[model samples]
Target: MAEDLVLDTAIRDWVLIPLSVVMVLIGVLRYFVSKLMRSSQSPDAKIIKEGQVIIRARNLRAGANFIPPKSFRARRAYFSNEENGLLFVPKGQAQNAQAQMFSDPNMAMDMMKKNLSMIIPQTLTFAWVNFFFSGFVAAKIPFPLTQRFRSMLQNGIDLSTVDVSYVSSRSWYFLNLFGLRGLFSLILGEENATDDTQRMMQMSGFGFDPSKSLGAEKDGLDIVQHEWALPKFEQRAEAVLKKLVS
Candidate 1:
């Protein structure tokens, strides 16, 4: 009996206890390491209300290129958020009316997803670029990466700006990876890839959903009919861009 008890105790402490402790330690390490890694890339930073500060500025390169040594592209004025003390842009639907016209639910969903596919990768590219060269800290970066990307949902006509919210840090990080690859397809003019991206933007939370509006309510934003023209939106966006830049 004594020998058996000793053996059992030995197994409990040496094997079970050690293993359990190691696993717990690993879990903790992973949690922190994940957060550290996430912070390095993009931490879903929050956005402050507009008109709450004096002014802020962000330097945006004309074209997207992550490689710094080769990045001779001219830097342009990336907008800034004074309230949040971060540089970012307010992304919103470029044309709500045009997106509403698709009577086919599948088609609308498909188109929204495609636009989201575009925005997501563009966002990821921006985040990855900021991670290395933006003079931001590795773990303690000051600017909000997620905040800016989330706002881009509005840039697509199918997507409502309100739906853009904080996703888990892990989700945000991986989303960027997938997004980058997807964006490459759009940039290269791959027809299938571009279509896939458009479809992605239209699919509910993954894209835009008229049933669920977000920022519009809070801002008392005017809602045009779902069947509005797309070109008009493009023109409006151009005008807005000019005003913002000027």
Candidate 2:
């Protein structure tokens, strides 16, 4: 009887525990899959009655895929009274069918499937290794290290570089991925810069300073006014005019 009990206990520890772990792992995966599918099913657009303004999406496909709000950079008229006259136009061709790819559920699903195939196996391998030697992973990766990684993945760039340049008024139109405008747009509230200002800043990044680069005059306006012309030139002009009149 004692020998039988010892064998039973050893079998339970070696077999039962691992089996239970595998079952729990399967259950967690199922739950996540269901949740992700449900999230993908929801409508991408929702209108709320926040105030008097009735907001409508101008571009449906662009609106669906995390596209930034419409900017008024291009509509800038040479002589316009309106503030948004010198508006910024966001970059990229909104007319192209490819631009609307992200809005399609099938495309998003396909992309996600491909991404998961690339990520899941590696993540599971890491998790299994970590489970076998728990303290080793935790000790090697401190809280601060993980925090920095998360911050970078989410924010991408630091706020310290924001004030480095005076963004231009027009560059805000091309504020997509080509320009750092897309990254800066992720910041909230007051952190966001106007299209013109951001464009100026972008120009500044290219070693262009509109404020100081003007060559003494612009558009026929002499920046440096030479007050009180030479006395000789003034006398000569006056004498010539008097002789002509006489």
Candidate with maximal TM-score:
1
For each candidate in turn, give its C-alpha RMSD to the true structure in angstroms.
25.2, 24.0
lDDT (Cα atoms) of all candidates against the true structure: 0.35, 0.32
Go through the candidates in order and give the clash count of each: 22, 19
Give the number of the best model, judged by lDDT. 1
On a 0 to 100 scale, what is the lDDT of residue 203 in model 1?
49
Q: Per-residue lDDT for 89-163 in model 1, tens only?
A: 234543442354344465544444445544554466446434432321112123334545643322222322223
Q: Cα lDDT of model 2 overall?
A: 0.32
TM-score of 1: 0.21
- Error (Å) of candidate 1 at residue 53 is 12
Residues 1-246, model 2: lDDT tens digits: 011111245434543344344434443453344335433444323112211011121222223223222221111121121332111112333233333333466645744553454356436744553344222101111122333343322232233322222121111111222343443345322333334344434433434322122211121121122232343676899999999999
TM-score of candidate 2 on Cα atoms, chains taken together: 0.19
Candidate 1 segments exceeding 4 Å error: 1-7, 40-216, 219-246
